[model samples]
Target: MALEAGTVVVDAAVTQAEPSSPQARTERFAWGPVLCLWVLLTGWSLLRVPIPGVNEPHYLGKARHWWNPDWCPGDFFLDSSNPHLVYYATFGSLTQWLAFDQAAFAGRAIGLLIVALGWQRLSQSLTGRRWDGVLALPVFLTLHATGNFSGEWLVGGTESKVPAYGFLFWAIGNLLIGRLLPAGALAGLAVSFHPLVGLWGVIAGAIATAGVLLQRRRRHDLQPTETTYSLVNIAAAVGLGVLLALPGLIPALQTLEGGDPQLEHAATQLQVAERLSHHLDPMRFPKTAYWFAGSLLAIWLLLLRDFPNDSRQRWWRWFVLSAVFIAVVGIAIGFGPRPMAQMPGFGWRSSLLKFYPFRLGDLILPVAVSLAAVQAVMSWTQQPSASVSKKSLLTAGLVACVIGAISIPFPDQNPSRLSPREQEDWIAACHWLRDHTERTAQVYATDVGWAIKWFAERPEYVNYKDVPQDAKSLVEWNQRLWKIARWRIAVMADGQVTPEELADLKQQTGLYALLVGRFGPVKAKPAYANENYRVYVLP
Candidate 1:
């Protein structure tokens, strides 16, 4: 009998029999120890300092805005422009109902929950051993740590790449299990969270669909029932995504009144330079010599002759293609532009930029580490063979472990955390603003607008940008207060705002309150200091 592509052609006559009871079948699926281990691993990963990077504060602020029902007047549809508003609103509502810290802890909790769910799905897909899910925990933690360190020097949290990856993984797992519609919906949600992740989902879906179609064609088996199920799944995914996106799409379409000529020119110039840079950088070659070498070795040792015989080989091929695609995108972008070069003390921008298309080469690091662990597990499972010396296999596995150990430690370099004192000081400053300012008062803070907007219960003038024209009057009013008071309550890094600017700001606002950081100097005395932050109330 000809076997199907995915089916394992086992010798059923010699195979062990299934248990005779319904309970036995149910019990087979419950792996308590594995689940426990997975939970423990997840906890360990989350405990690593909350890496505040890549639009994290913005999302938190947006969530806070959503929680305040009285806010966002006149523009109901404009609220949807913030991609994370839905996620934040949902979490914030729950936190508000429970009287929890809606700004800080609640946002982190939701992120953790999403990651955990994603990991669970990934583990189920890869090993069918729920415990193996813990293996991928390090990937999430390491990326967050890296982001935290990087955030110190640049605008880090503008994108939710980590969370996006989690959703993408979940969608892919669902797709593999033949739940097409749910997978598509999950993939759609991932895209809504971060558009780049949606690319991965598309790739995975296309691959799976193509594989299924090819299998059907080769077998000359036209099974209408199975085909119908697959088609339904695909349709469901598309339909669900469209439904969810309708809210955002409609508003976006209405908002496209006209394009700015200056912006159009700048975009065209940037695109030309981006293309040119890709050609000049040898280091930005699509294939990393090191990764290519390792992949070749893996194929030679494990998959060279076994492709047609092993189902696992097909999965491996899919993974390889995905990784390669991600790598190519990263290389292209890494060589593209030095957009963040103007920022002070952040020369490492180029290195971090490489992660844009999921950092194809960096992804190999996790895959390599996981493979080592898998090999170790397989070695432990197999019985001793006189012909195949267990000692050699054990030594090889240890060497792989050492390589992974070395790799993981290096990636953890420059882990950053705000001291408890700093946290307390920042919190106090925010609270002071909350108590002093009117609920509807718009605050024009420099860097910490999002933090203050959410934490201090005031309307932020603008987030991560200078106050727009719509709020120009509010900014001028704040400036007047600073000038009269000889103090300015502005979030500043070491040299971000000059003494002259501070003096001018004081002259402009007539108020004396300035929040300064290591990035800049402050003209006013710090009323409060923390390990990672300082607050100066202008006298």
Candidate 2:
């Protein structure tokens, strides 16, 4: 910060003197922070394999599907599927240019860069003196580095949310900078990739825009042209997002009741419909509710402690208010959603934020913690006459360290990837299936995971994790899928499969039931056996 007219003016992260030349503007673009972001995230995902049934295999499979439609699950579900096509299409293009695995890894690395750069922009736009923008790298890396156990961002690998958040950060950053049109466009892009954050962004953009207009009006500087321009910008921004999402949404509408036989009986529709359901059993709220509540409280206090002190700060203040309102609603939805309070198909629209309300905790944590962490760093580095320094800063730092440390359950440095304990067994089973099974052979696993589909190139009977979208077909799909899953579990518990069970299993999986976990020696024919699992080849 520099003294300007007897008031401290923020320098927007760069500490050195101003650059005179136009080229300096481009040269000043900070690459170091982006490098750090890449290194940290790339290092974390290095151990991750891009094979099917690994690290959000369903989503990965979808992305890979676009690259090679002839792959597992094939072009059969192509028309009826309601996956995040925008996200997949982007990465799918990458796969066409690069090796599949490299493309996936590159996507993750680039996604982190987008987020890091967006945070820099956001910090510069918001409390410029607070974070200095540069601090966003460490703050973000630390949050992710705390490991997926403390939290995981939607999936362990490069899932849709990564890029969604990348766009979302930019949207908020633009909003803070009073670039409403771009903000709206980015917000729409975010939603197109990942609907949750993008919807929140719409609220954020509206709040920030309102705050700006109100301030201008109060100063007696409001112009009719300004209002017109603002409205036009808002429409264009939202219009851009809708255009991005049109492909995904349009298909969902067109084929809601029309498709092939498999499509008609498909589980994708059910998963989609379930996602649109807002009312839930309140009993499901307790554990997740507490997590969201705690995070909400943490962010609110951080914001309340420092109200607006400048134009940038004013932008943050309105954002903070919008954020708080969103959090409160999320908490309410998570904790005690009134089943009858909402209209029909609330979750399907933009407002019914109740779909997976608890995950909102994970969504907000990075934003809140990143802002708070960077601001704290700024306090420590600034002049001795800083408002809060030395002891205050030290205490806060220690507290953060303790909170972070306690969150990680293990002694080994927070392994963002899965440990050997979990991954090794999964690897063995998936590899065995890949090498032994025919491409045409379908298998039945307890729960589809990792890259099982990718490596095995065989569809499982019911992939619970691979939730899809639907209208009337959703109920039937869930019922049928769960029935098969339950039957598989029951047969697993029985150890020796009944003649009847064997017959049904044979029909569902063609001839093999690839079951995992402990089971006693079976009297029935066992095709293969390992320490942790067994393959039942139905005769």
Candidate 3:
């Protein structure tokens, strides 16, 4: 019999004879042990990586700027469109009290905690065992670290997508149990943080749900006992999701609209060809990535030799298949016979490619591998026991070794994409700029990377690493980068520029100062000099 609207559909693995209430659901899983394991593992993961990770400054700087516009006033990329407004409003508000580095550490800890808890809940729900999540945690972390076909990762750094993935995991867990409304609400929250991460999850989940319904229908004569959500429930979930996601959805949609065709095309091509080719272009993937992905798949298949017959197996199978199908479609589109522009339906495919279709599979497949391995091991070992077996001791030893190796706190931890000496010199130069220069000062630096605005609190003239998202701004940002490149090649040599060149750059770009790596053959004496860098005051 089909349940009425607003009913919480229980999983087939869960006994249907039990009274279904919110309190019963809350008490379904033991939280104490899961939380303890989550904290230890997640804390270790966060501390393993240093702060200001590759994209940390990229995101946290913008976040700081969002709350306090005066932080990096007039910076081009900082002033660009705000697609992750919800993230800025929530996590970015940390700038009010904490320093940028401190905020990054705090944010990473919280986000990873959410991710860890979500993964545990999902694992436990899918396996119908309390300790499966703990068993799978180390494997999941290791696989996620090494097994990505695209440049996608779950842990590391503070960004909008961290929390988005957390909520996405929760949504997927709820979906496994047919709790559509809660799943939809969680998915919507994920979208509010980062649209693409959550939207791809929703698509994969919808496909899985469809497969479940079709299979159930085909086997109607057998009268399957598993619970499935009705169409009305799906509609309500989608409706609630849309309603909750408007804050982020509206702004993201706006970026794609109201752009000149030529400018938009230029922006799309730049993103696909130059800026994000490593992510969007499948042909460019490294050979090692393929090996890693293939190895994980082989291991999963080997472990799951005979798939367990359980009520939840169908959902797990369908979800994995959906994720793989999405990845294959992405590969097919990206691996065009010719250039994307030369292909049929060029605009449609290029635009779709930008959303990164391979990401879902890159992330999801690792989770599946972890869960499947845990299920297999648990089944072979029988029920949970207080006595630790020899195999259990071995597994624990392996987990400890892996965690210790990755979490080695090296002395020379330079997190700002700079070498130890360069980071120190860069910070000193930025300190000079922050103290000596005005807030309106626009400094130009080619090799400083992304943290000048973060450390110096001054606007940047142009930075190649920081690209604006809006169509017009993207084109302009590109032009500025090329102009800087041309000037550097023509005039600057051996990390040196003459006074005449400095004056010309000042006149051309209205830059207040020039910061360059320390080198000889400079015609003009610098206003400030460090062991690794020099700051030249412009005319």
Largest lDDT belongs to which candidate? Answer: 3
Put down candidate 2 lDDT per residue, 469-490, tens digits, no spaces: 5534444446647677676678
Best by TM-score: 3
Query: Over the full model, what C-alpha lDDT does candidate 3 score relative to the true structure?
Result: 0.73
Q: Sort by lDDT, best first: what order? A: 3, 2, 1
State, as a TM-score between 0 and 1, how close model 3 is to the true structure.
0.89
lDDT of each: 0.43, 0.52, 0.73
Candidate 2: C-alpha lDDT: 0.52
* Candidate 3 lDDT trough over 10 residues, lowest sum: 1-10
TM-score for candidate 2: 0.72
Backbone clashes (count) for model 1: 37
In model 1, where is the ten-residue run with the lowest total lDDT? 7-16
lDDT of 3 by residue, 496-525 (tens): 667888788788888898888743346888
- Backbone collision count in every prediction? 37, 14, 0
Alpha carbon lDDT of residue 252, candidate 2? 38
